[model samples]
Target: MKGRFWPKARLGDVTCVMGTNGVGKTSLLRAISGTHPRSSGDVTFDGKPLGQMNAHKMAQMGVGYVPQGRDIFPLLTVRENLQTGFSCLPKSEHFIPDEIYQLFPVLKEMQTRRGGDLSGGQQQQLAIARALITKPKLLLLDEPTEGIQPNIIQHIGEVIRLLRDRGDMAIVLVEQYFDFAFDLADRIVVLRRGEVIENAAKQDIAREQLLSIVSV
Candidate 1:
């Protein structure tokens, strides 16, 4: 099955992809982000083919990826981790946007702390903040709430909502938490064994039916 995303080039538009485990969810993100090579199919973004573009190239093309594991540079300070995203931007845009701090004030407070020293929730915030540093046009987030505390999960959801409301970048979220995905998604795509089994707008699909589709 194939899933395509064509952003209206506006902010606050969100596409949520949901599925059971091992259903090629992460593979899809890897292919789009150019982190893993795809043997077939085409990925076109903004009317251009993304053929053979490495992760760096994808980043330069305004794609920001926050992988599932919240991968952070353990030894680096939070500020330094954010600075790494500078490679994707021009020298003039090197500074972190004030909005990032506004979205996650904890990051600013822990600017000098090593990434590994932070708790699970704090690390996740840092991962997301680092991605935002690139000021991407398309943001890919994989399971932002996994392993996080309940309060932090709610906070993460709030941040996602805020990002969407700003309406500058399109967000593609991969989440297994059905309720969370349902709340933020303008549209939902469900997959099974790498096949798209369900695709519809949130209001168009009934809640129970959508749950059954993904469960299958």
Candidate 2:
């Protein structure tokens, strides 16, 4: 994740960190997630600066990150993987809500299965479900459709649409798939080298323009 804008890194809104491979998309998300520290520029949420926030504090403040890899605990049962999200909440509030199942009923069906037993798409769903259990205001998704079947990709896209339509959360989608990103993104931020080369609303740009902007 090295590129042009290691010199300047700052983002907000429904920012899509898109570019050719190796343009620092993951690094940017990692920086925001506190998994990777910014060499410089501050990361903030809801207008409150992140100068004071660490990883645990960021989660408490509702920053959810679904990293590039679907890092579900393969040894744990599906239910146990979801429960890991509860560690962020108070003891009284530590339980999975029904809405999470509504978002992914496959999870409900496989609650007893070991995480390693699920398919790739199922694992992706579990990863996202794990993140949502924290009830974040800002969701960072990294190449969610990468390596999944088309049907599952559609489902994941629909889920993202539903979340964005709710309008309470700001989503940062880091993707290499132009078509998938186009369908769900409200705004497109194309990165080249590292700087934000083009930032435009979906209404303001076309597919070719977006593709060209991010093309190396």
Tens digit of per-residue lDDT, candidate 2, span 118-162:
999999999999999999888989999989999999999888888
- Residue by residue across 12-32, what tens digits does model 1's lDDT show? 678888999999989989988
Query: Which stretches of candidate 1 lie above 4 Å from their native place?
Result: 2-11
- TM-score winner: 1
How well does candidate 1 match the true structure in TM-score terms? 0.95
Whole-structure CA lDDT of model 1:
0.88
Q: Which window of 10 residues has the lowest lDDT sum in candidate 1?
A: 1-10
Alpha-carbon deviation at 171 in model 1, angstroms:
0.6
The residue pairs in collision within model 1 are 11-167, 11-168, 12-164, 12-167
Best by lDDT: 1
